[model samples]
Target: MPAERMADFRPDAAADVTDVVCPVTFVKALAALDELEDGRILEIRLNDGEAARNVPLSLKDEGHQVLRLTDNGDGTCALLVRKVSACPVE
Candidate 1:
Protein backbone atom coordinates (compact mmCIF):
# COMPACT_ATOMS: atom_id res chain seq x y z
CA MET A 1 0.00 0.00 0.00
CA PRO A 2 2.76 2.40 0.91
CA ALA A 3 4.51 1.61 -2.36
CA GLU A 4 1.39 2.79 -4.17
CA ARG A 5 2.51 6.35 -3.59
CA MET A 6 4.58 6.00 -6.72
CA ALA A 7 2.01 4.33 -8.88
CA ASP A 8 2.84 6.57 -11.77
CA PHE A 9 6.30 5.11 -12.18
CA ARG A 10 6.64 1.46 -13.01
CA PRO A 11 9.86 -0.45 -12.49
CA ASP A 12 11.95 -1.40 -15.49
CA ALA A 13 13.41 -4.39 -13.67
CA ALA A 14 13.11 -6.25 -10.40
CA ALA A 15 15.38 -8.43 -8.27
CA ASP A 16 14.54 -10.47 -5.23
CA VAL A 17 17.40 -10.88 -2.78
CA THR A 18 15.53 -11.99 0.27
CA ASP A 19 17.44 -15.27 0.38
CA VAL A 20 20.76 -13.45 0.31
CA VAL A 21 22.63 -11.75 3.14
CA CYS A 22 23.77 -8.13 3.49
CA PRO A 23 26.54 -7.49 0.98
CA VAL A 24 25.30 -10.00 -1.52
CA THR A 25 21.84 -8.54 -1.27
CA PHE A 26 23.08 -5.23 -2.53
CA VAL A 27 25.27 -6.98 -5.06
CA LYS A 28 22.37 -8.76 -6.70
CA ALA A 29 20.34 -5.61 -6.80
CA LEU A 30 23.26 -3.74 -8.26
CA ALA A 31 23.81 -6.40 -10.87
CA ALA A 32 20.22 -6.14 -11.99
CA LEU A 33 20.42 -2.37 -11.94
CA ASP A 34 23.58 -2.50 -14.04
CA GLU A 35 21.61 -4.09 -16.84
CA LEU A 36 19.19 -1.21 -16.99
CA GLU A 37 19.41 2.04 -18.92
CA ASP A 38 19.82 5.32 -17.16
CA GLY A 39 16.66 6.61 -15.47
CA ARG A 40 15.23 3.12 -15.35
CA ILE A 41 13.66 1.76 -12.19
CA LEU A 42 14.81 -1.33 -10.31
CA GLU A 43 12.65 -2.99 -7.74
CA ILE A 44 14.54 -4.97 -5.15
CA ARG A 45 12.93 -7.21 -2.58
CA LEU A 46 15.05 -7.85 0.52
CA ASN A 47 14.85 -8.66 4.17
CA ASP A 48 13.90 -6.08 6.77
CA GLY A 49 17.11 -5.75 8.77
CA GLU A 50 20.52 -4.71 7.56
CA ALA A 51 19.78 -5.32 3.88
CA ALA A 52 16.84 -2.97 4.04
CA ARG A 53 18.78 -0.28 5.86
CA ASN A 54 22.03 -0.43 3.90
CA VAL A 55 21.07 -1.26 0.32
CA PRO A 56 19.21 2.00 -0.31
CA LEU A 57 22.02 4.17 1.04
CA SER A 58 24.54 2.16 -0.88
CA LEU A 59 22.56 2.59 -4.09
CA LYS A 60 22.28 6.30 -3.44
CA ASP A 61 26.01 6.46 -2.93
CA GLU A 62 26.37 4.81 -6.32
CA GLY A 63 24.35 7.69 -7.82
CA HIS A 64 21.00 5.94 -7.97
CA GLN A 65 17.72 7.52 -7.05
CA VAL A 66 15.96 5.69 -4.22
CA LEU A 67 12.33 6.18 -5.07
CA ARG A 68 10.36 4.15 -2.61
CA LEU A 69 10.73 1.55 0.13
CA THR A 70 7.71 -0.48 1.13
CA ASP A 71 7.00 -3.08 3.78
CA ASN A 72 5.24 -6.24 2.65
CA GLY A 73 4.33 -7.10 6.25
CA ASP A 74 6.11 -10.40 5.92
CA GLY A 75 9.59 -9.55 7.15
CA THR A 76 10.44 -8.39 3.66
CA CYS A 77 10.53 -5.01 1.96
CA ALA A 78 10.57 -3.71 -1.56
CA LEU A 79 13.04 -1.04 -2.65
CA LEU A 80 12.32 1.06 -5.71
CA VAL A 81 15.46 2.54 -7.17
CA ARG A 82 15.91 4.60 -10.29
CA LYS A 83 19.20 4.31 -12.09
CA VAL A 84 20.36 7.87 -12.42
CA SER A 85 23.98 7.05 -13.17
CA ALA A 86 25.30 3.75 -14.41
CA CYS A 87 28.82 4.53 -13.34
CA PRO A 88 30.05 3.16 -10.04
CA VAL A 89 31.49 5.46 -7.43
CA GLU A 90 35.18 5.16 -6.79
Candidate 2:
Protein backbone atom coordinates (compact mmCIF):
# COMPACT_ATOMS: atom_id res chain seq x y z
CA MET A 1 0.00 0.00 0.00
CA PRO A 2 1.01 3.59 -0.43
CA ALA A 3 2.82 5.17 2.51
CA GLU A 4 0.43 8.10 2.69
CA ARG A 5 -2.51 5.83 3.26
CA MET A 6 -0.90 4.61 6.45
CA ALA A 7 -1.66 7.93 8.03
CA ASP A 8 -5.34 7.28 7.48
CA PHE A 9 -5.10 3.57 8.04
CA ARG A 10 -7.12 2.31 10.90
CA PRO A 11 -5.13 -0.35 12.65
CA ASP A 12 -6.60 -3.25 14.57
CA ALA A 13 -4.31 -2.43 17.48
CA ALA A 14 -1.96 0.32 18.56
CA ALA A 15 1.10 0.58 20.82
CA ASP A 16 3.30 3.33 22.18
CA VAL A 17 7.00 2.72 22.84
CA THR A 18 8.23 6.28 22.72
CA ASP A 19 8.91 6.19 26.45
CA VAL A 20 11.18 3.15 26.19
CA VAL A 21 14.56 2.51 24.64
CA CYS A 22 15.62 0.14 21.87
CA PRO A 23 15.25 -3.63 22.08
CA VAL A 24 12.60 -2.97 24.69
CA THR A 25 10.79 -0.84 22.16
CA PHE A 26 10.78 -3.63 19.64
CA VAL A 27 10.00 -6.04 22.46
CA LYS A 28 6.83 -4.21 23.33
CA ALA A 29 5.82 -4.03 19.69
CA LEU A 30 6.44 -7.74 19.31
CA ALA A 31 4.48 -8.44 22.45
CA ALA A 32 1.59 -6.43 21.06
CA LEU A 33 1.83 -8.31 17.79
CA ASP A 34 1.70 -11.54 19.73
CA GLU A 35 -1.74 -10.56 20.93
CA LEU A 36 -3.01 -9.73 17.47
CA GLU A 37 -4.68 -11.98 14.94
CA ASP A 38 -3.21 -12.80 11.57
CA GLY A 39 -3.90 -10.17 8.89
CA ARG A 40 -4.42 -7.57 11.57
CA ILE A 41 -2.68 -4.25 11.46
CA LEU A 42 -0.64 -2.79 14.32
CA GLU A 43 0.16 0.86 14.72
CA ILE A 44 3.25 1.41 16.81
CA ARG A 45 4.62 4.70 18.06
CA LEU A 46 8.39 4.59 18.67
CA ASN A 47 11.37 6.77 19.34
CA ASP A 48 13.04 8.25 16.30
CA GLY A 49 16.55 6.85 15.89
CA GLU A 50 17.15 3.28 17.02
CA ALA A 51 13.71 1.93 17.76
CA ALA A 52 12.40 3.48 14.57
CA ARG A 53 15.16 1.81 12.61
CA ASN A 54 15.13 -1.59 14.25
CA VAL A 55 11.54 -2.52 15.09
CA PRO A 56 10.15 -2.34 11.56
CA LEU A 57 13.19 -4.13 10.17
CA SER A 58 12.80 -6.85 12.77
CA LEU A 59 9.13 -7.22 12.00
CA LYS A 60 9.90 -7.48 8.31
CA ASP A 61 12.63 -9.99 9.03
CA GLU A 62 10.05 -12.02 10.92
CA GLY A 63 7.81 -12.09 7.84
CA HIS A 64 5.41 -9.39 8.85
CA GLN A 65 4.57 -6.48 6.55
CA VAL A 66 6.15 -3.19 7.42
CA LEU A 67 3.53 -1.14 5.69
CA ARG A 68 4.45 2.41 6.50
CA LEU A 69 6.42 4.72 8.75
CA THR A 70 5.58 8.36 9.43
CA ASP A 71 7.79 10.72 11.34
CA ASN A 72 5.82 12.66 13.93
CA GLY A 73 8.39 15.43 13.76
CA ASP A 74 9.01 15.13 17.47
CA GLY A 75 11.73 12.55 17.74
CA THR A 76 9.18 9.80 17.24
CA CYS A 77 7.51 7.94 14.40
CA ALA A 78 4.44 5.89 13.79
CA LEU A 79 4.83 2.47 12.23
CA LEU A 80 2.10 0.53 10.49
CA VAL A 81 2.58 -3.23 10.37
CA ARG A 82 0.47 -6.06 9.11
CA LYS A 83 0.68 -9.39 10.89
CA VAL A 84 1.30 -12.10 8.34
CA SER A 85 2.12 -15.03 10.60
CA ALA A 86 1.23 -16.31 14.01
CA CYS A 87 4.83 -16.31 15.22
CA PRO A 88 8.13 -14.79 14.33
CA VAL A 89 10.32 -16.80 11.97
CA GLU A 90 13.38 -17.79 13.92
Candidate 3:
Protein backbone atom coordinates (compact mmCIF):
# COMPACT_ATOMS: atom_id res chain seq x y z
CA MET A 1 0.00 0.00 0.00
CA PRO A 2 1.06 3.60 -0.56
CA ALA A 3 2.55 5.61 2.27
CA GLU A 4 -0.32 8.05 2.05
CA ARG A 5 -2.88 5.30 2.48
CA MET A 6 -0.86 3.61 5.20
CA ALA A 7 -0.71 6.89 7.05
CA ASP A 8 -4.45 6.66 7.49
CA PHE A 9 -4.61 2.97 8.39
CA ARG A 10 -5.74 2.19 11.89
CA PRO A 11 -4.59 -1.23 13.00
CA ASP A 12 -6.78 -3.46 15.06
CA ALA A 13 -3.80 -4.76 16.99
CA ALA A 14 -0.05 -4.30 17.32
CA ALA A 15 2.94 -6.43 18.34
CA ASP A 16 6.60 -5.78 19.01
CA VAL A 17 9.18 -8.38 18.07
CA THR A 18 12.25 -6.16 17.83
CA ASP A 19 13.79 -7.95 20.79
CA VAL A 20 13.43 -11.45 19.32
CA VAL A 21 15.23 -13.39 16.61
CA CYS A 22 14.18 -14.93 13.28
CA PRO A 23 11.65 -17.69 13.82
CA VAL A 24 10.62 -16.24 17.15
CA THR A 25 9.89 -12.91 15.55
CA PHE A 26 7.59 -14.48 13.04
CA VAL A 27 6.03 -16.63 15.73
CA LYS A 28 5.17 -13.67 17.92
CA ALA A 29 3.73 -11.79 14.93
CA LEU A 30 1.59 -14.78 14.05
CA ALA A 31 0.40 -15.08 17.60
CA ALA A 32 -0.68 -11.44 17.55
CA LEU A 33 -2.55 -11.92 14.32
CA ASP A 34 -4.16 -15.08 15.67
CA GLU A 35 -5.65 -13.10 18.51
CA LEU A 36 -7.66 -11.02 16.06
CA GLU A 37 -10.55 -11.96 13.81
CA ASP A 38 -9.87 -12.38 10.12
CA GLY A 39 -9.65 -9.09 8.17
CA ARG A 40 -8.20 -7.28 11.14
CA ILE A 41 -4.94 -5.34 10.65
CA LEU A 42 -1.82 -5.80 12.75
CA GLU A 43 1.09 -3.42 13.19
CA ILE A 44 4.27 -5.35 13.91
CA ARG A 45 7.35 -3.60 15.22
CA LEU A 46 10.46 -5.63 14.37
CA ASN A 47 14.14 -5.16 13.93
CA ASP A 48 15.55 -4.19 10.53
CA GLY A 49 17.84 -7.05 9.65
CA GLU A 50 16.74 -10.69 9.33
CA ALA A 51 13.40 -10.22 11.00
CA ALA A 52 12.56 -7.50 8.51
CA ARG A 53 13.45 -9.72 5.56
CA ASN A 54 11.78 -12.89 6.85
CA VAL A 55 8.68 -12.05 8.86
CA PRO A 56 6.76 -10.35 6.08
CA LEU A 57 7.43 -13.20 3.66
CA SER A 58 6.42 -15.74 6.28
CA LEU A 59 3.18 -13.94 6.93
CA LYS A 60 2.52 -13.71 3.17
CA ASP A 61 3.14 -17.42 2.82
CA GLU A 62 0.53 -18.00 5.50
CA GLY A 63 -2.03 -16.07 3.38
CA HIS A 64 -1.95 -12.64 5.00
CA GLN A 65 -2.00 -9.32 3.19
CA VAL A 66 1.06 -7.13 3.70
CA LEU A 67 -0.10 -3.57 3.73
CA ARG A 68 3.16 -1.77 4.32
CA LEU A 69 6.62 -2.05 5.80
CA THR A 70 8.10 1.24 6.93
CA ASP A 71 11.54 1.90 8.35
CA ASN A 72 11.80 3.77 11.62
CA GLY A 73 15.40 4.96 10.93
CA ASP A 74 16.49 3.38 14.18
CA GLY A 75 17.18 -0.24 13.21
CA THR A 76 13.50 -1.14 13.35
CA CYS A 77 10.58 -1.33 10.95
CA ALA A 78 6.82 -1.23 11.24
CA LEU A 79 5.04 -3.94 9.28
CA LEU A 80 1.38 -3.49 8.59
CA VAL A 81 -0.49 -6.71 7.81
CA ARG A 82 -4.07 -7.70 7.37
CA LYS A 83 -5.04 -11.20 8.43
CA VAL A 84 -6.65 -13.36 5.80
CA SER A 85 -9.13 -16.04 6.76
CA ALA A 86 -8.21 -19.64 6.11
CA CYS A 87 -10.33 -21.91 3.97
CA PRO A 88 -12.80 -24.09 5.82
CA VAL A 89 -11.42 -27.52 6.72
CA GLU A 90 -14.49 -29.22 5.40
Model 3 lDDT tens row, 41-86: 9999999989999999999988999989999999999999999977
Candidate 2 vs candidate 3, lDDT winner: 3
Better of 1 and 2 by lDDT: 1
Full candidate order by TM-score, most accurate first = 3, 1, 2
lDDT per residue for candidate 1 within 32-85, as digits (tens), equals 987999989999999999999999999998888999888999999999999986
Best-performing candidate as measured by TM-score? 3
Clash totals for all candidate models: 0, 0, 0
Q: What is the C-alpha RMSD of each candidate to the true structure, in Å?
A: 3.0, 2.2, 1.8
Q: For model 2, give the 10-residue run with minimal summed lDDT.
A: 1-10
- Report the C-alpha displacement of residue 67, candidate 3, in angstroms: 0.2
Please, what is the TM-score per model? Answer: 0.87, 0.85, 0.90
> Candidate 2 residues 21-40, lDDT tens each?
87888889989998999989
| Candidate 3 least-lDDT 10 residues | 1-10
lDDT of 2: 0.88
lDDT of each: 0.89, 0.88, 0.92
